[model samples]
Target chain A: MSAAEDRLPPLRRSSGSVGRIALIVLGIVLALLLLVAPLAVIFAEAFSKGVAYYARNIVQADTLHAIWLTVLTAIVVVPVNIGFGIAAAWAVTKFRFPGKKLLIALIELPFSVSPIVAGVIYILLYGANGLLGPLLADHDIRLMFAVPGIFLVSLFVTSPFVAREIIPLMQSQGSDDEEAATSLGAGFWQTFFRVTLPNIKWALLYGAVLCNARVMGEFGAVSVVSGNVRGETNTLPLHIELLYHDYNAVGAFAAATTLTVLALVTLGIKTLIEAKGGGDPHRPRH
Target chain B: MAGALTARRVLPGFGPTMGLTLFYLSLVVLLPIVALALKTGEIGLARYLDIITGPRVLASFRVTVTAALLATAINAGIGLLLAWNLVRYDFPGKRLLDALIDLPFALPTAVAGIALTALFAPNGWFGAPLAAMGIKIAYTPLGIAIAMAFTSLPFVVRTVQPVLEDVRPEVEEAAASRGARAWQIFRKVIFPTILPAFIAGCTLAFARCLGEFGAVIFIAGNLPEQTEIAALLIFIRLEEYDYPAAAAIASTVLVAALVVLLLANWLQARSQRHSEKTP
Candidate 1:
């Protein structure tokens, strides 16, 4: 019935029926080819070798290690970024300060930077011949070409997600609630926990979800830094690259299926958050 | 004197939060940029120019910029169409189509890279038909543009959607009441309002394409002077242990990205101000 209603001509005509059909068909075909087809290809290739083959490939020790390392990186990167995000948002929105615009721009710097350049920045700072490299060498500390390097670059890449979400939200919500709470004899922590946290919780979680996805899927910077040792430092995306280069198409797609599942979950949560009225922070209000 | 003249804030966490914000910002962003600058500075200006202007480097820049431009052009058109349909029409699977626009952003670029490459490779689904017609997509600059377009697809669509939504129905109604045709209403009434936002979205999409790495590499085929992108070139330089050359090439890319980002920011701000002024 709804389909029949959609097929009916418009009560008020902005575009002709023929033009409308043409445009909708064009959009759908493009979405199918550009968006849906890639996902279909991943799942098809992943299961092409049979369910048993796919399962066996995923459970391999190296692949399992890659999964674990990827999870570990997300665990570390997400919460720290959440902290930074909250702090940055809190300071930017709740207070008047010097160089406020500059601070916001700086926070967004990672988003604009090429990930390979991000990797090189660290290399310039911590690689063997890097400025701090010699200094760190004397101390026998390793940062680049290791797990720590992976964590750092992931941090750089995802640093803005949470703060970017919250700053606009907190700004819109205003300081009135917190100010009222403070006047009512609430302490800082009490006001923040009871007032600010509750108000911004959904946006905070939305930001954290995005930050987590980026951390898990980050490739270029992590590739440049993580020496890509099979069981030692390879994250899931890096492992997929390694598998692909080795012509293990099934293994690569198999591992990719996991990240694919994560991407779907992220999209689901994003839609849910939007439905919950935590609407996309980046979208302008009507 | 200026600092002392302002009244104190009533907020409690300002000191601590600002402290943490500045501290972390320096460690994560500012310091690394400083490191980049220091390294680039170490390579004298003459050598820096020499490295960035080298024949291979110049070719990669040409390929990267050209592909990015092509991708941005496609994104501008398709994104505008998609956003228009999404905001203006209701179809059977409209909501699902809206949700799927973000797939490129959420999906790991490596997964996107391999999936796209498989689809466009000679024996793959789309590839077989196109190859029969003597058209090739994978392992060429065309593939690079397609990959760039895939990754940056959401930028223009997402940016334009809300702005389009904000174009009040009354404006169109007013035009319609005046006996204006559909195209006239759009071209005159609607286009003027959304132009700043549309341009902003295109600029941002272009900037993102310039920096895109993971999704482009697998399909790029990494030929030295032909299909290679700037980001890949920087990676190759790093692999060769030529730090100076890598830093030099990266400096150029970095500066371009920053400048483009600033321009996009300015355009977005202008759009916001424009919207506020409208109603």
Candidate 2:
């Protein structure tokens, strides 16, 4: 018998197969218990009273404001990173550069740095006694413990996503298309807008999706910088914490459920994108 | 060809690229790092050492490293098994299982923390059963480890999955033809091939655990010199307005992370070289 057949004999024999099937079933059950069941509990608890309770708690002014702040932060952070991503990818993949390795490493620094550390760095740079703090104070400027501080920390944490996504796509596609465009008399801007952008468009979208998810979900960095001011600086994640601590579990779970739903939707979208992008013959060539 | 050649030459190749790269690095990465170093310097080397090597800092480091290492080790085995099952098996709910693996990547850390804490608290459904066995999870180091493991599991699973899929089944069949037992074939053939990817995944998971804060903070109970992690310690220092001390602690963490990253890259490169030579 083939090795595959030999391995299957135990399965074919109902008596000996019981143990193996049981083991496989146990593994699946454990994973479900650990990962899925808890989420089910959270959702059930949130909606236990009714949709009215969820709607009322989730639509409260503070919760609404936190969600709005989170969306605003995503708006501010995603675009800046996308721009930085385009620039960095253009520079790294399109050119043979000195200090290229160093630049790549620097771009990835945020990935390695703790989000809490990112918050700390911003505070050191913009807090009242910070290096830029006195100069800002002279100008009556406030960066920390405010909206800008939240945005800044979000920026630091999510900066690497777009660049990382674009770099590999650009590298594999090469510079031939751009050169051909330029030869065909397309100007730099035109070449970029026409050839380069179209090619990296999918990657750019994927990166932006990832960046948006992270910025909205961020907690540690924003927590340190925002000072958790009730309605002023609180983001959704922080709002959940505040409500939970206040024994407002329903409100907290309502906010949590909203974020969770958003996350699940993003995951679904990402899966579809990956499936479409995977092994497709339509990818743009060098 | 002539136009392409001139474009290559006149397009301001390495020089401009290097200049932009350095400028960007200096602005966004190096400057902040330099500021951290200088702040630490202001406290003098002795004081910096004192703060970083203090009892609380030392305890945090020990706990963080211990928990991270244990979690990564556990993940390396379970992640590889899961990858193997996903790639080789034709099971029911396979699609659902595949999608579930990425949940940690998308779930907000704070929400995850809350969910985990609710499930593992003494009164929590899961925790209550375990608590009956006299094992405490919530507000303890075990809870920290579980949270880290939960968040970091995807890194290992995803990293190893693609590699396993690429490992053609024919090789395993060949080993079997050579009279190797199933376990033997796995150890001698499949294990070596997938080992590097597993290690890479473990390293990524370890680095993540080292820096994990959001989920851990909720469950770790944040006791000084006990449940406190390095990230929490840094946060506490910053909250107290102890910039110098915070910078000192952060620098130490940064240096440790750099070392792990270097080791990971080195292992990856070595594995690639081996594969290239063999093929």
Candidate 3:
């Protein structure tokens, strides 16, 4: 038995059989309990009230408005963020500049800041009692407690995704393609559209998908600035909170079901992108 | 030569792209941060100290920190196990399991909060069994920790997975051939290689948990002096039109987050150095 064990290659060398089984079982149980159960519960509770009830909740005016608002936010936010991301990636990757590291860190600052703090800073800047409050009030302009406030905070929260995704990718790939195209007498737009864009397209999509998902599901920051009007300013995540608070479990879960599906689709797209050899969107390139 | 080559701009869009990046970064991020600083400064040092040190606020900080620490501890262990399993074992549904690790990141925090609450509430699925044993999860700090753990679970697993995968099997094979015990090999070899990433991941997860609001509030029960978190207190202060108070508390959290981010970056740099030296 000892000789046979020695004859086995190191890769085939087993830890104690009982220990291996125990570790696997523990891993599976933790994943199932911590990660999988919450997901299963969302679908289960969403449909707990039957298809008619779930469907009715889904199309309710408030729910529809919330969904619409979330879509509007995503629609406006994702494109702007994508533009910012591309620009930041371009500057950071292609040029040597002073304060580049600081710039990258600043771009990543929002990811570290609490979303609620994100909401508060904006309110301090633009709320009715804020620094610009009097100036805005004179002109009847509202940024906080309005759609624009929601947009601003959402922008702050998801600002890093696109740039963070593409920067490392662009850095690793180097500026060779862009430089080559430029040296070949290609204009900026032509090189970007034909060369730089193709190389970073998947990463850009990955970033955009993540950005859109966060915008739709954003709760902490949006909750602060939205003013929580039921059918008016509420986004999907806010709508779910409203329903849950009102003891409308079915309604809340139904709304949650929509966001959950969005989350799943985002994950699916992310996995597909990874399979297509898009760089891992989150890791720093060593 | 390399520095000179890099110094010469090779791309024409630098002027346009760099201009846009700075302009947007300022308008969206820096200006608000400056506004926050101004608000906090206007509140004066005494008032800022008083508000942040009030009993309720302090209590909430304790709860937030304690729960976050607990959650980070849980994540480090489970995340390591899962990362190790995924990298080493040939299990059925491995691909699916790998995908599931990121569910926390992709799912909305509010959705996660409610779903976790439903599962762990006393009358709910997991809660019922545990309740029969006289232990409660939801509506307690334990619940808050669970929410934190759920939201931050991917940090450790994702951070450690690549490092573990990079641990050449040949090294392990050599050790095994030399009759090193499995535990000894792991402790002496694999553990050192993955330590920096693991610690960095935990720090990040801890930082994230400290600021976690949406996923935590639903399950936290939001009781003052017991279950309330610092982030919710900031919201409460804001709701009451106490802008100065909210700003003060938020400043503290913000400073802590920045400190944590700096630490994480340093650790990551160190990890990179370690990998480079070893390779």
DockQ of each: 0.55, 0.43, 0.64
How far does residue B16 in candidate 1 sit from its true spot (Å)?
1.1
**In model 3 chain A, where is the ten-residue run with the lowest total lDDT?**
A7-16
Residues A1-286, candidate 2: write the lDDT tens digits.
5555665322232233444465557658767876797577679668868999999998899999999999999988899888777878888887774677877888888888887877877777778877678999999999899999899888888888888888988889888888778768887578788999888877788778878899999988899899889988999999999998998877788899988998888777776766767212111110
Better of 1 and 3 by TM-score: 3
lDDT of each: 0.90, 0.79, 0.90
* Model 2 stretches with alpha carbons more than 4 Å out: A1-27, A278-286, B1-26
Query: Model 3, B240: alpha-carbon shift in Å?
Result: 0.4
**True-vs-predicted CA distance for residue B247, candidate 2, Å:** 1.5
Q: Which ten residues in a row have the lowest lDDT in candidate 2 chain A?
A: A277-286
lDDT string for model 1 (A1-286, tens) is 3654433324234444788888989999999999999999999999998999999999999999999999999999999999999889989998887899989988888998998999999999899988789999999999999999999999999999999888988999998888778868898799889999999898899889989999999999999999889999999999999999999999999999999999999989988998887747335210
Return the interface RMSD of the candidates, in order shown, one decimal each: 3.3, 5.4, 2.6
lDDT of 2 by residue, B171-236 (tens): 776776677765687688878887897887889889888988888888888888789999999988
User: Which digits, one per residue and each the tens of the lDDT, describe model 1 over residues B125-171?
Assistant: 99899999999999999999999999999988888998988988777
Off by over 4 Å in 1: A1-16, A281-286, B1-9
